[model samples]
Target: MLNSFDQKKQKILQEIQSDDLDLSPKGTIDELCIPIINLINSNDDMVTTSSCSGRVSVYLEGTKSNRAVVSKGNHGRWLFVTHEPHDLKDWTSKINFVYTSSFPDPNARLILYKFEPLILHVKCRNLETANKLYQVAMNNGFRESGIGSNFNVAIRISIKLDIPIGYKSPKDEEFEEDILNLFVTKDYIKYIDQLSLERFEENSKKLNQLYKAIEKDLSNGTVLTIKTNKPNWESKEERRRRMVKEGLKRQEELRELKQDQIQ
Candidate 1:
């Protein structure tokens, strides 16, 4: 029998590789471009090979592309993708996984790397946890960028995960719904603190799982880089003052132009 970690990896690889783009909606079709872009960003070159593993499903939002991607493995299911913001790169990073979720869900696998441009490889066990995690991460401050409207991404690399069955969380359902209350704004630092607190208070058991997985990575010297949001210092007043100065300079030049015109 495959070890727990090996099993999870296999599960993730199979799901992503088997996704049907045609059956997928326009928004999902767009997400496929994400890995291609990420591969480029990571190496400034397209990846010759990329794949996804696990049984993953996506649901779209009515406006823009509001969708959540979920994954299922022998172990359990959790939210994988919350909101499919056009820029899919926003949803990826690398981490350690004993069973992926820091718990056992292969879909919530956190793939980590060393000395690579920071990227988080996210594969959640279900859409609910995926959505909740995204909201919480964004509420803690994260941003997505890249790709014009024409090119949307749906599928990307897949990895397999093998986890023992019957590890799903019942609380995650309620947590997913409450995720809407989270947001990434100027007060993001506060939100991050609140989220960390809530995470400990609400889901200490699962948090311990994630902690163990991450602990292994740290011990092995696998660097983890998470993106953080900071407030922009320039305010409307500062911007306006700079603009006004430029406008005054233009007016002076206009006056000189009239003098030259008359002469």
Candidate 2:
């Protein structure tokens, strides 16, 4: 089993080094987490299969009422994406164009801005290695890390953080009015755009700190080995015998208690 696992690991490492494999949305690994990725890949027992440094995006989706009436049906479309902070004026122009454009049905004009968190998937050589990695990730603020599988490849470690930011019904008049009052701005759209950008920057910095923590533990060999919840294998006969023994022990205790009560 060890030999077979080693062979598979070598094959996967070769594929990762080759140019044919693209594990990122933009065909490039995230620069922010590149050091962490390199550290994991350097280990003999692990390799990263996919990763993302997270992003903020502007998108449009049709309303429920519009979905049934539209010929092509309602679908979400991304208008912009950035991994770093963006200017308020830049997003304001894009949002205005999307809202004012006639190509999208009037009912499909809800624009939204969103922030996503950093994510990474690591493939471990075995379940033990996966458990160690999962422990380290959870300790470093990646609370969503866990084990996933792909057919026979049993130990895929998923690392994720769930920091999300979004605007709902950005083009709604009442919503716009409320935000305009709060920010004291006649250009309420620009105000919201700037506000979202600032929040995104804050969340991005938090994610970066988490990454650095993980990298530090990994480099310093401080990651702890914790037992995972994976079940142990047992034959049907062995399980049946164990259950029978436990039942017999319980019966003996009950009889002893009854006898003592009678005495």
RMSD of each: 23.4, 22.5
User: How many clashing residue pairs appear in each of the predictions shown?
Assistant: 68, 0
Per-model CA lDDT versus the true structure:
0.29, 0.50
Q: What would the C-alpha RMSD of candidate 1 be, to one decimal place?
A: 23.4
Candidate 2 residue 131 Cα shift, in angstroms, is 1.4
Q: Quick one: how many clashes does candidate 2 have?
A: 0
Residues 154-233, candidate 2: write the lDDT tens digits. 22123222221232233356554211111123365555566556655655565566556646654446432221111236
Best by lDDT: 2
lDDT of candidate model 1 versus the reference: 0.29
Q: Give the TM-score of candidate 1.
A: 0.18
lDDT of 1 by residue, 1-263 (tens): 97553455455434433422222112121222333223222221111122221122211111112222332222211222222222223222221111222343343322111110112334333454344434433332223312222121122111222222112222246544211111123243233333333432333233233334333421234332211111236564664454345444544555465445423
